[model samples]
Every structure is written in C-alpha cells, then in structure tokens.
Target chain A: MKYVNLVVIFSLLTFFACTSSDSDYQVSDIPGGYMPGDTARDFQLKNVNGKMVSLANYENAKGYIVIFTCNTCPYAAMYEERIIELHKKFADKGYPVIAINPNDESEEPGDSYDEMIVQAKEKGYRFPYVQDKTQEITKAYGATNTPHVYVLNKDRKVVYIGSIDNNARDAESADKFYVEDAIKALENNKTPEISKTKAIGCTIKWAS
Target chain B: MIKPMKNVNLVVVFSILTFAACTSSDGDYQGSGTAGKHVVGDTARDFQSEKVIKFPELQEYITTSTDDKVKVINFWATWCAPCIKELPFIDSLRYTYDPDKVEVLLVSLDFPDQLSKVNKLLQRKKLSSTVWLLDESDPNLYIDKVDPSWTGALPATLLVRNSTDQRIFLGKELTKAELETHINKLLN
Candidate 1:
C-alpha cells in the first residue's frame, strides 16, 4: 500500500514538475563553415541607415572583425562599450568591426531591425550595425552566440574565431583580450597565439 | 505475488521510460561561465548527495573517468531560452538509461544571484537529475577542459566514453533523436 501511494505521488510530481516552457529555439538546416581555414561566404545585410552592407562596402580594410551580436542579450549589452572601443582602436588599422544582429524579431522583439536602429543611434555606433534578414549570414558563419567574433584576412579566411576576450562582464578586469590580441598579431605579421577561445555569450536567436 | 502498489510503481517507471524515448529537439549554448573546485570526478558513484560542486571537481570526473561510466555533461543556465527548451529532454535521459551505464551531470551556469531561480525551476520541472553549479569565474582556465570543440554556448552537450575513446561534443542544442543516437553509439 505504501509503495502504491509512493508511485502515485511520484507520478503526479513528475507531471507537475516537468513539462514545456514555450522555448522556440531554432537551428538552421543548412550546414555552415566554421573551421579556421575555411573561406568566408560573402553576405549582404541591411545597415541601420537603410543601406545594404557587405564585405565590399569596406574595400579599404586589410581584414575584417565580423562580430555576431544582438540587442536583447544581456551579454551582448555588456560588451557594447568595449565593442565600440574595439572599432575606435582598430578601424584605422584596417581591422574594422562589422556587427550583425541575426535574431528573429518575432521571437526576440527587442532585437528587431527597428530596435537595432534605435540601439545604434543611441549608442553612437561608428561602425556598421546591420541585421541578418534571414539569419543566413549567421548560419553561413556557423555563428552560435551573440558577440561571436570571426577575424578574417584579405582573402576572407577565418583567422581568429571565438570570443572578444576571456571576460565579458568587466572589460577592465579582462586578462586575455582574444580579439584585440588577434588584431595586434595580424599587425605584426604574426598569427594570433590563441586562435580560438570559446567563452560563453548569448545564443543567437535563430528564426523559427 | 507482487502487490498492487508495486505494480503501480512498475507501470509508472515504464511510462517514464516511454516518455523519455519520445520527443526530440536540441540546440547550441554560448555564454559566460563561472567555476569552483570539487573532486566530483573521483566520486561518480557518490553523486546522489545533492551537494553543490565546484568546477575543478567536475573536471576530475572528465579527466579521470574513474568509474568507466559514460558521462554526459550538459552545460546550461536557468534563463537561457534554448537551455530551457531542451531541459525536459535532457532530464529524460536519466530515466532511459541505467545509472550504472550513464551518469548525467547537469551543470547550471546561472549567476550567483540566480541560484534561487535555478532551484525553483528545477523543482517546477521536477528534474530529479544530478545538478551542479559551474562555480568557476574564469573561462580561460576551464573552457578547453570541458571540450575544445565548445565555444561557450548553452544547451551544449559533451559525451565522454573512455573505453572507446569516443567524445561527442555538440556545441549546439540537440533533438532527442540526435542525443539518443550519440548515447547509443557510446553504449555500443
């Protein structure tokens, strides 16, 4: 009798304790290129000013710092100022920061193109902050998180792929600046020592 | 003769197993992770205490693989949408496999302030699986240790099977079918 009661109680507990939470996480069916030696696929994204921006837009750059970031994620917001600083410090050196928000607006309303424009204007963004229309740009790069950085060379080879640095919360306290170090290495005609460092960041909101 | 209560228990357990077999969908997780130190690797058989473990100890489980059981370490957070999306499926793995063959370590990466939220969610979800807090603050010190393929994403899963030297590292979230396939490979 006791065992029967326990089983009944446990069954009810399982039903009450577990179920769905209405999370609509989407993954792209198309395979992506993420390995270090792969060439990047050229993608066109709409900038905040209603202009189509692609790799050709920055013809003067020696390489590119393609950062996949969004407005809604707290981690992305934390790196906002530092990302601005990255542009300020590296753009002149031919390594410009191109920010892309690949989130689906229906699921992540805060990351919609309209909200992106507002964020760019309010943040005084000096670089191109664009929106991935179909999130194909995100999938082509195999981008998994917001603020995921892929440093590309003149030939569009993914030279450095990973986080901006080891620390996301407190930039000042950061010990290893992965993105900065990669750029600085490229400047000296050397490879970034730590080519890939996978740190945590916000998952890119994929379109359902 | 088995009592009616015993029969009920058997029925419920079998039903749970069936529920575990169905349902599929998973994803990749990327975000900041914290750390701490505990020697969980040394004590896989003793993981039922529900005591919070630090990062180093968890690594011990990975590095040592002392007990030779297949270890499925899932890195997730309470607030992550994808992480929550696949929680039940990940939790279901527990009921599907015998404990002797599989040890599921659910490492929650919630911020220190969000511990209560994690507790509540675990309770509400009825995740009776083994849960741990990745008490590490430094990513550089331990990210590679988890799996070199991971880029710090949530809903990420790592399967470690020492006997076959097989490690399935899915940096993204997984469907139940995908997860089961990996587990079956390890089991085989």
Candidate 2:
C-alpha cells in the first residue's frame, strides 16, 4: 500500500511539472544569452582611439558596463546621450561604460570604424568606442539588439542584461533606469531585483 | 495481477504520451467560417488607413479576431534592413492565401515621429496588408507581454489562432518557405 501511494505521488508530481513548464516556457530561457549570475568572458577589441580595450585592462575597476551599439541605428542614437550620462555618473563610482560597435561596415557602411570615430568625436564620448571587427564577442555575449547592455562585476559576472532604460523614444520621459538601478544594486552589494529585461533594438547586422 | 506500483507507473507513462499526442495535433484543426475575403483593390489606398495604437489596443487586436482568421502579426521597423527585405514575403501572404483564413497584420515598430517614413516605404513597396505602429513608449513593458521568448529583436512574428489555442512566436527573420510552412501548419 505504501509503495502504491508513493508511486501515485511521484506520477502526480511529474504530471504537474510537465504542464507548468509547458505553460510558462519563455523563449529567453533557451540556451545562449546571459542570465543574471552568469559570469561573462572578457573580450579584446580595438577602440576608436587606436588603442585595444579589454576588461583585463581595468585593474582598479569595481565592474564594467559593456554595451553593444553601433552608428546608424536610430534606437542606438537615441540612447547615445544617456549612455554618455551613465559613464559620467558611474565611471567615477567604479563602473565605466565600454561601448562596442558590432555591426559590419560592409553591411552598414555608416557603422565602419571611421564613422564610429566620427560619432564619438562629434558626441564627445568619454568612453571607449570599440569595434567588434570579427563579431565573435557579439556572438559570445548573445546580443541580438544594438544598444544592448551587460552590467558585470569585477569578477566579470553578468549582473544585469538588457536595455539602457525603460523609454527608448524620449530619454527625458523615462521613469525607470534599468542600468543605473543595476549599478546601484551592485554598489550596495545587493543583487538587483530585476536582473533581465528586453527592449526593441536593431538586429545586430551580421556580415554577409 | 500486476503490482500496484507497476500499474501506477504504467498509468503515468500512458497519461504523458496521451498529453503529448493531444497537444501535437492542437494546431491542426479546420478553421471555421469564411470572413477573410480581402477586396482586391488599390494597395496604397488600403494602407493609407494605418494608425498608431497602444500596447493594450494591440493586445485586443491580436486576441479578438474579426473573422476567426489566423493572426500573422509581424513586428518590423522601416530601418531594419532584413525586415524591409522580408516585407514583400509577408505581404505576399495577404493576396496568396484566403483572406477568410489568414489575416496578415504588419505591425511596424517605428517611432511615432517616423510615421511618414513608414508610409513612404509601405507605399513604395506596395504592401497591401493592414499595418499599425505600436505606440508603446517603453519596450520593456510590452516586449515580454507579446511573448516571453522574444528578445525584443526586430522582424519578430506572432502567429496565433486563439480559438484553437495556437500561438507560434518566431523571433528571427524568416524565409518565404518557412512562413508558408508555418501558415500551412496553423491552417491544416
């Protein structure tokens, strides 16, 4: 009788598990892409200033704000000033922004290294505007959208991943600052309540 | 007689298989009614009626079907090269399939200020399907509500038939054959 009871309980548990998972299966839960607590690997790419930048170079940094963005994407352009603000606000507080353009120049000539340099100069970017010439780092980070961000700790662990803020249309109207909140959480040595989010962005133009 | 534990195990396995079988054919059902007859007329004139809608309006648009037609909601933007490239393929479904069966809605993700650009492109492309610009200011709020699987990437599509409980979300650029395969799967 006990064995029969045990079997019934096991079956019920298994049945419920299957149904629950099926109903709540998120596409983001699929493999690839970083979830919170995932340790991100370091990358080496050239900056617009003719210098190679990497996470390893930041010896005294508490964490890094690595953003995959490019020129010509209107969405990215909208976030340009906000990204600059993030660096200004947090760079001295231990987290600095490292912008990388992952688009292929062949596909989007405007996103070429020279254009990145021009944009950075024009915008007075205080951060490194690097070029992911190979886009291998982009694949590793699983960044599908341009202007996608990954907030990492000193250990290179991804603490928050997604858009810069809640509002992409008008920055002044944005109520929630996702990246800033994540950085604040890290500053307090507390895990962010909301770690992952999604934003509409230009699909990272892959080389033909 | 078989042992009680063995019998329970058999029941569990059988139930799982039955559930799987039932779910597999859930999308395979004959669509009811014929209300999707789209009038063959001026393509640009039809597209001129496009409007900007909020997220809740879009939700109602997807769930509440006008004719029990399968909803092919393609989320695209004018600036997205691949999305522009695939617009014709998605638009092709509007004329190729029975309007009473499949209702293709090209939902543009363009900013409200870019309405003119969207209009010019649609007119240039001669796209005939109904279009709407999702006016939600915050993508974080609406992106997941569409489908948790979506990463907020451009050129995503939602194929849904609520009456039959079928919702297939594709978050990548699709080819012509792939779109046809999905439509056929949803239809029959």
Q: Residue by residue across B59-174, what tens digits does model 1's lDDT show?
A: 87776766767888888887577788888888788778888888887888765434445645664565657777775656767766675445676778888887656666677777
DockQ winner: 2
Candidate 2 residue-wise lDDT, B135-174, digit = tens: 7888877886787667888889988887766667788888
Q: What is the lDDT of residue A42 in candidate 1?
A: 79
Q: Per-residue CA lDDT of candidate 1, range A39-158, in tens?
A: 898788899999998897787898899999988776787788989999999999899999989789988998889999999999999999999979888888888777788998877888
lDDT of 2 by residue, A1-208 (tens): 0112324433554565577522223433223656678899898899999999999999889999999998888788878889999999999988999999999899889999999999999999999999999988888887888889999999999999889889887788888888999999999998887787788988888887
- TM-score, every prediction: 0.71, 0.80
How displaced is residue B150 in candidate 2, in Å? 0.9
TM-score of chain A of each: 0.84, 0.86
DockQ for all models, in order? 0.18, 0.28
Model 2: per-residue Cα lDDT at residue B145: 72
Q: Which predicted model would earn the best TM-score?
A: 2
